[model samples]
Target: MNDSAPSPTDLLSVGDVSRRTGVSVSALHFYEREGLISATRTSGGQRRYARHVIRRVSVIQVAKRMGISLSEVADVFADLPPDRMPGKTDWRRISERWRGRLEARRQEIERMENELVECIGCGCVSLRSCRVLNPDDELGADGAGPRLLPEIPTD
Candidate 1:
């Protein structure tokens, strides 16, 4: 093997990326399937990803930790220039959007904390707490399911 450094445009195999980024090959494939990342095929039909995918995968990891969903990540990526790797400016744009989402989530958590404090003296049972939270079975108005919770679409 030559001792020369690889070029910036070199493509990485799925396993190589997985090893470098701590993301599994299966997850990489899933990201590609979800349009969060893209890959090109070689003459033999093997998937190869641009080196920039490492940074992209790292961003995906951080976003998921912050409760950003894959669809949300895809939306953010969609706004970036399609012909190039995401630069600092592109990341900053997405970061600003994510900041808004995190701020909203923080406010929700604070509201829940205050509600729990209010419940402290009630000695409320599980169902009682549900009733107090739901108030007059309001969730039932949503057609017999947990209305406050988001419904996940299944494949």
Candidate 2:
């Protein structure tokens, strides 16, 4: 081992964190801005992250893949100490909190799949026959744009 190399317990540079976590340096900075993760500054003004941040970044990546927004990740992270790594107990709590939302998303996707099958079976490509997009032509009265599709809730 090179004596100049950082130890496992030592703080990691922004680039070090990026390479280890496979998350871009820009994303690490973004996470900092969003309060999802934090870092310290070196005497030269370089960013240095705690080694535990690797695990935190992994959690963030998984949550994002599951459709959880950065704000949501921030909310979960807020429940824990910013300076420490999240433990298994912390992860259990976070996963339990997110379970309902993930289930709801799953159900919505299943419903859409069934609706799509029904729409296809009807053999009418028109908006009139499309149950998912416009059921009973109710959207026609609303004056254009998608109607029956679930509206994406904004943060």
Candidate 3:
């Protein structure tokens, strides 16, 4: 680390944010336009951001990994104000709101695994009685995907 480089505790310039986040400067500008993040502007119109903003956008990236939409994440952010970065308590609160959703998705995956196992076990290769079947018809009719594909798990 260069002695002249801003400390992690110091506010990061737009270039620093880009370097640390591996997000290009242009994209960061786009994020600002999309209202996903904001930065303070210097008198010369340069942008400066709290180092915590890097963490915020990192969190957003991970959420997107789970198939969350940007608007949905914006809605999540809407629940809390930006003046205070989320501390552990705020994190737990936010996570609690998502816990049910996470659980539902987890259960869906587990059920699908069970269905495939059952299909193999029954010797009939039918998913109708698979323990994983959602009673609400979540799987829909047989036309969905390869109905009985027991491909080698992707490890």
Candidate 4:
């Protein structure tokens, strides 16, 4: 038996959390500093977060990939009370709130699909003939991507 005293299963340190989440420690610190995620402090004042932080970090990464800013992502989780770890139901509710956003994205993709199909059979890339190109229906002149693509709501 190779047992010494079994090593203690320590809680995830800030660095440990970063390694697990593939986010840099500085970014983890930023998340905490910006009030995005919560953590416990040791007697030495080092930050320790629950393992669930992996999932939270994953959410943050996905939201950022979707072009959501940190402040905006923080706003998404702001109403969520951290005293209770979000279960599937809680997460589902949060996702449900984005149903409209997802559907709008879906619709925009469909519009592009039709445009692409049209372009394949005919030489038509004109904004006048394409819903995807003429995305003014969804967006104003402010952001990137198709103007017809609606902006993701910030609130």
Best by TM-score: 1
Model 3 weakest lDDT span, ten residues long: 125-134
Query: Sort by TM-score, best first: what order?
Result: 1, 2, 3, 4
Query: After superposing candidate 3, which stretches have Cα over 4 Å from the reference?
Result: 1-9, 109-155
For model 4, how does the per-residue alpha-carbon lDDT over 1-155 read when each residue is reduced to its tens digit? 33532222535798898888899999998898888888888799888777667778887897777655678667777877664456787678666766666688889888778767766766665655655566563444455555556789998
lDDT for predicted candidate 3 compared with the true structure: 0.71
TM-scores for all candidates? 0.75, 0.74, 0.58, 0.56
Q: What value does the lDDT take at residue 82 in candidate 4?
A: 66
Clashes by residue pair, model 1: none
When superposed on Cα atoms, how far off is each prediction in RMSD? 9.2, 9.1, 11.7, 11.4
- TM-score for predicted model 3 compared with the true structure: 0.58
Tens-place lDDT digits, model 3, residues 1-155: 97754454587788998998888899788877878788887788888886667877776776667776778667777776674466777667656766766788899888787666755646643444444444444555644665456778776
lDDT: the better of candidates 1 and 2? 2
Error of 1 at 79 (Å): 0.6
Backbone clash numbers for all candidates listed: 0, 0, 0, 4
Residue clash pairs of candidate 2? none
